[model samples]
Target: MELRHLRYFVAVAAERSMSRAAEQLHLTQPSLSRQIRQLEQELGVVLFERTTTGTALTPGGAAFYHHARLLLRLAEASREAAHSAGEATREVVDLGIPPGLSPDWVVRLLGLLRDEVGRASVLITEANSAEQLRMVREGRLDLGLVHERPLQALTGTRLFSQPFGLAVRPDHPLAARTECTLRELHGLRILAHGREQVQAAHDALIVAAHERGVTPLWRFAQFSEHARSCAEATESDAVVLTENSARRLLPQWPWLRLAEDSVDLTTWLIWQPATRTVVTRVAEVISGLAEPVTVPR
Candidate 1:
């Protein structure tokens, strides 16, 4: 019925003498005998044939011997395996990253984590903020880096803020400006991502225009790929993100420019108690790298 009973039975069955088994198991003979009697009672079958020479297994005892031995060995093996996995898990940390985050930040975060934790084995996943948040909650991810406003249910530490602006080809007239007002390009096409946030961004820009007594024309690009495609297309005065996204694409696409005026964005790192140590170390590394870099005001 219980593991201890199985242990006592296996020991007695292997030794074949209650006296010898008790000596080996460090128990009194009567105590061992009582345990065997209890085990037989629970199973409703006699296990041992008592003889003047020694104890022998009954027919039922022989059959149960094989199964009980296997069960005991399997239980031991499971405990060992679980212990090994737990040891490895203690040294590993998994992180979930937002899909649109720059590869540079991802690489930086991983390198920092490895150096900080030494034995850290990192697993990385790329998903949207919503998906990453869910993964963190479900314990599939230890932490996440995202740009959405922090949910009340989830605690987060803000990392950095970036401005939103138009990305354009170098040949575009707006690209040559040292600085320009929103009204200068009142009727130009625009590209942007996000559903509600993009709309919010648009409204903010429109409000900026209204403050300057001008109206700007725009269209929404729901994904980064679409925004990039619009930027590469000819006659594309497409609205574009003026955020730090440009910094990420600069190495590969060196011709994108920040449009005159746009909103700014902030990013955060989110995690729960289980990931506190790793996240704190990571935040320290990010903070060190995030030194006061100058940006357009």
Candidate 2:
């Protein structure tokens, strides 16, 4: 009827003597005997037979002993499993990253996270900023790196800012210049990422080029791989990208900063407001890694 009843029944059946079981259980002989009698009554079965030598099991007592021992073992195993579950020490954090980002930066961030959160595992997914923002809003991703602050109910922090630069083939005339103005890129065919892939950055470049009175014929591709293929096939005059990404993604080409100071690119770290503590800690590490560096013009 109860766990204690099963335990008492098993102990009494094992020792075959009321006094011995009582001594082992730290219960009075009368108390232990009464408990065993109550168990037999509840089951309507005779268990132990009184004997002049020592108590002996009746036919029913032998059968009950087998199941009673199993029940006690199962209960102990269940308790241990529950306690282990409550003390779980590891956590997994899912992070989304934009494509064409600097690999070196990502490696450094991952290393820092591993060191700081020893019990945390990181899962990385590559997606564009706009897509990453949508995934974070939908609760599919715990954190993301995006080009602009998300307009959704999520929280965001600025990670770092980079200047826009031109990537061109080695033989291109612009490759020889250390820097060039947006206005000077006019009349040249250029390869650019699609508006949907990086909405904020793409729109900003378009608006800045328009304000500078430059209207290059722009060829748009939806993904970084496609944009790179287009640039190689068409031998386009140049492709625009952040200085860090340009150097890592297309190292064969030369990267030249845009002479216009206003053409800066910024990256933000975004996550759901209810993100786990591990994700928040990782965000802090990223913010610390974003300190500015001075580069001579």
Candidate 3:
């Protein structure tokens, strides 16, 4: 029998009088009787006993009542669950970020996402610029912060262009200088992230240094903890990285800026053009960030 039959049976059993049950259901008494009769006939069981006092349930009716109520409750729960799933799918946004983004920037982005996007939540995945770009292009990531050159394939906005710097020990001779060119760093061993981490930016800086008739000892490390461990183990005199990374990874040491205009790292925010509106909102917030400044002291 249909759900309406179960409902009619329930109402009649609850009220005990057919006329009162019909009133509550907004159906005429004859219509209500016909519906109840249809349900009993479909089940091939007598669900109610008629008498002068009032209508009452049979033993069979009592048994069916519990099962009918339970079925209605389950149906309602299923509908609510489906609706909630749809809402969650719409509200969650996936974001990819490269390593060494400042904690302040991360916090600011997260806070703004909560306040501005309202019910949206961000799922952050950390990968290098290359991987992040690929993820964004492949539609796996809703938004990405990458260091690679802008592509015609995806929508992008440049957020910061931080010059590279050298982090050296206090006693190092270069520590006294605020900034120096790659040509000036001749013969000194310098550690940096490999091309695997920031392929375009790293390669460009190396090529520029070579073109300037400078060839220094090049040491390669990954990011943060790995770089620190390698610095302690190797004879590399200085660490070459962005100002943000240098300050966080080698705090208390001197940061010497590389004077060559081309010897710097730039970051961009990239996303698919047709992505969810929440992703576009997040991109706008990031693009509004003030360009980072370099401090050499």
Whole-model lDDT values for every prediction = 0.67, 0.80, 0.82
Task: Score candidate 1 by TM-score against the native.
Answer: 0.56
lDDT of 3 by residue, 1-297 (tens): 898888888898899999999999999999999999998899999999988889999999999999999988888899898888856454678888888777777877788878877767889999888888889888988888888876898998877777778888777888999888888878988888889888877888788888888888888877655666787777788988777787777787789887764466777888998887777887887777737643222
Estimate the Cα RMSD of every predicted model relative to the unseen true structure.
Answer: 12.9, 14.0, 12.9
Superposed model 2: Cα runs more than 4 Å off: 1-88, 292-297
Q: Is candidate 2 or candidate 3 better by lDDT?
A: 3
Deviating ranges (above 4 Å) for candidate 1: 1-90, 196-214, 232-235, 247-262, 273-297
Q: Write the per-residue lDDT of candidate 1 for residues 109-200, one digit (tens) a residue.
A: 66776777665677888776667777878878777776666577776777665666555556577665444556665777555564544344
Model with the higher TM-score, candidate 1 or 2: 2
TM-scores, each model vs. reference: 0.56, 0.66, 0.66
Give the per-residue lDDT digits (tens) of candidate 2, residues 102-214.
Answer: 77678877888889877678899998887898899988998888877677698888766777778887788988888988888789888887888777778888988887788
* Model 3 residue 71 distance off true place after TM-score fit, in angstroms: 23
Clashing pairs in 3: none
Model 3 per-residue lDDT at 235? 76
